[model samples]
Every structure is written in C-alpha cells, then in structure tokens.
Target: MEHRIATFLSRLSRTWLAAAVLAAVAIASATPAPAQDFITVASTTSTEQSGLFKHLLPEFKKATGIEARVVAVGTGQALDMGRKGDADVVFVHDKVAEEKFLAEGFGVKRLEVMYNDFIIVGPKNDPAGAKGKDVVEALKKIAGTSTPFTSRADKSGTHAAELRYWKLAGFDPPKGAWYRETGSGMGPTLNTASGMNAYALTDRGTWLSFKNRGELVILVEGDTKLFNQYGVMLVNPAKHPHVKKDSGQKFVDWVVSPAGQAAIAAYKIDGEQLFFPNAKP
Candidate 1:
C-alpha cells in the first residue's frame, strides 16, 4: 500500500508540472510581439533643427509603420556615418559628397530628396556691407572688410558651400582674426553668429526656424550657387552585412514618393514653407 501511494504521488506531481508548463507556454504565446521595426538614418542638422523631420517623420511612420531614427549632424558627418555602417540610410545636402560616398561603395544609390537655398545672415545694421542678392559678391565684401564672420568649419555641407563661395569670390578659405570657425552644427553656429553679430551662411530652413535672431537678419539670398540640394541613399548592405536594407530602402523609396513629397511641401512655419520637395516622380 505504501508503494502504491508513492507511485500515485509521483504521477500527480508530473501532471502538475505538465499543467504549469502548458500554462507558461500559453501566457508567452498570448504576449504582445516586440515592435522594434526601425531604421537609423544619418541626416543633416538642417532637417532636424529646422523642424522638417518633426513634421516629415511622423507621416513616414504612419505610411510605412517603420520608425526612422535620425542622427542629425552635418552632411559630412552623416556621410561618414554611412561609410562606417553606423547608419542604415544617409540623407544629406551635398550632392558631390553623396556621389563620392556612392563611388566609394559605401552607399547603394543617391536620390534627390529636396532642395532649399542658403542665405547669408548678419547683423541688422549690415556692418560688413554684405546685404545683397548676390551671394558670391556679398561674401567678397565681407572678406574684403575685416568684418567678423562666423563659419561652421565642421566640414559641413554649408561650410563647404561657404568655402566654395569664397573661392568663387577669389578668396582662399579666408582665415584671420576676422574669421571665426565654429566646429559645430548649424543651430549652434547660427547662435554663435548671433552672439558675435558675425556674418554667417545658413540654409533658409534653419534661418527660418531660428528664433534667437538678436540683431541678425537675412543679408544675402537668391543666388544660384546657394542652392542646397538634399539627397537620400541607403547604406550598402553587402558591405555591412548587418544593415537594415529593406527598411532603409523603404524609407528612400517613400521619401521620393508622391505622398512624401506632398508631406514635405505641407510642412510650414507660420504658413511659410520650410523645405520645397523636389523629388522627381
């Protein structure tokens, strides 16, 4: 009788163990799935700081159900991030740099996303006498004088354009006590320019978004050379072997899509458009 009772108890324990395991499995199966479908995009500060991403990304998320996590830096840094496989996509404003990145096999392809021109901002008084529609000529005047000019010398797209304008104006990357190179993003560099009342070259989007004007005002604009073209590219998955290619390409495809272009065109500050979507259909 004792042996029989021992066997019965052992069977009961096994039944309970099986029931517990089944219950645990059921609970796990009923649990919600992880919603971590996202891609990292290395983009420029102009897109982020100018509130373009704030307005644009949500629309993208709604359409694709994939989140775009942006690392907003200068265009150069963004490209570098793509090169290092630190990001799944690169969205930046330098066509030359973007082409170089593609040529070097870091990016799969480059597509034009949008375009916004750059403007020269300076003190309201225009101390450098740089106020004009001619960007190159305005830069020339600023350099000719010992006018304090602030440069975002972080090798950014804006900085590259600034240097190009200088070179076009027949100056060799002007450097002196009058020139200040702040190795910083667009917003901070603009802040510095405001603080110093120094001349600065900035994208129209950022210039519009910036509120701490102090004495700064748009001094020069409407020059063809100041045209800033933004491009998007996917990081080469074959090169990285770990890149989220499907999601990244989805974003690239969406950004140039009709819906994306409409969304970009709809984003405005005080009804003033920020970025004009120029994505070719």
Candidate 2:
C-alpha cells in the first residue's frame, strides 16, 4: 500500500510539471507583439542638405526602434505636406508660417529646435558690390545695380525672407535682366545662380553643402534680419486622424532634447557648424 501511494504521488508530480511547461508555452505565445516601426517626416532642404538627418537619425532609430523616413523639401512644401496629411510632422524654418499653421490647427505643440543666419551668396567678384554691407543695404545694391540675381520663388521660407528683404530695401524686385525667379528649390536655385554667375539669398546650411559651386561666396551676413530659426511640430492628429501622434511626439521631443541638440551642434561641413541648436521653448 505504501509503495503504491508513493508511486501515485511521483506520477502526479511529473504530470503537474508537464502541465506547467505547457502553460508557460501558452503564456509566451499570448504575449503582446512588439510595436510597429515607421514614421514619416517632412523637412527643409537646409536640414537635408547639411546631412544632419544622416548623422543623427540612426541614433534615434537605435534608441527607439522607430525608423524615420524623411521627405526633404522646401519649408513651403513641407508645411503643405503636413497640411495634406502626407507627412506625420514638419521641421521647417518659417516662423510666420508655422505660427499660422498652429493658429489654423494644422499642427500642434510647435517647438523651437535650432537657428542659423541667411546670407547673400554671389560670385567672388561681387558684381552688385554687396560685400560687407548689411542685408537690407545689400538688397538695395542688388536692386540698384540690376546685377543678375536668381530667386528661389518657390514660396519657401528663404523665398519669403527674400521678399521681406526686398520690401525692407524699399524696392520691389523688378522683373527683368536683374531678377530671375526659378520656381524650384534652394539647391536648384543655387545651381542656376552659379550657372549664371548671379547672386542668391540662401540659408547658411545649404551654402555649406553646395560644394560644386565654386563662384558663390558669402557676401552679406551677420545681420539680425538674416536670423533664421527652425522649428519642429507634430501635425495635429485631430486634423489628420491617421497621423501617428505618438511617433510624431517622439520625434519632436528627440529633436529638442539634449542629445538631439548635441547631434546638430556636432554636424558640420569643412569644420563649420551649419545650424545653431535653439532647444529652448
């Protein structure tokens, strides 16, 4: 009788152990899946041209396991992409347009990320004689001399700023030999200007990235009007219900975070810092 009881207890213990192993397998199979990994961002040519994303986004992906696919365009197109729900977020340099976007509820939680000054770039000969003058004065010369100048004219942030400079200079840029509008992006405008040996108003970052253009030189710089600030914002999920708010917020937060600022500060061309990180507010 004692032997039979002992045998029965041993069998029961083995049976329970097998049941526990099966239960563990079931629990493992029932565990929640890992989140999906993809996000879309619309940003400016300067950021793309400066190679900041290539330098920084891998770090973001490694940390968060979220892949960022960037669509690089002018600030106007980037904002428009966000408005049209083609992009999950926007990182751009036009403060006025960004404010308008927020006011219109197209985007939310707009945050300042970085800043850099715009400069007038032209042939080293300085045909307009714009060198060393202030931005407004330079524009006046560019207009007064009727020196060949190329304008982006793509409604980009840089284009908008150029128009502002023209206004400040007390002259509407005339349509003629002196003024040429290319309905293209910064890179293309730079190429066109270089081809024509014409002056162009451009952000510092794009100018730094423009290597093949040898004639272009920074003519007008260091003015307060040339101050260009870039901001990042998550598209309002309420407006575009498909926009991944979680991923967008993560991107915005990463860009403004200390790590992201450090990455921006570290990015350079020919040892020159392109963008100044303005992570505050």
Q: TM-score for every candidate vs. truth?
A: 0.92, 0.85
Which candidate achieves the best TM-score against the true structure?
A: 1
- Summed over model 1, clashes come to 0
TM-score of 1: 0.92
What's the lDDT for all of these models? Answer: 0.92, 0.89
Candidate 2 residue-wise lDDT, 1-281, digit = tens: 99999999999999999999999999999998886777899998778877888988998888677888899888899999999999998999899999998999999878999999999999999977999749988888888888999999888899889988998898665567689999888888999999999999999888888876868888899898889999999999999999999988898888899988988899888999988898984
Model 1 RMSD to the real structure? 2.7
lDDT of 1 at 39: 96
Worst 10 residues of 1 by lDDT: 167-176
**Clash pairs, model 1 backbone:** none
Candidate 1 lDDT, 106-211, residue by residue in tens: 9998899889899999999997788889988898889888899999999788888888899988888797899999899999999999999899999999989999
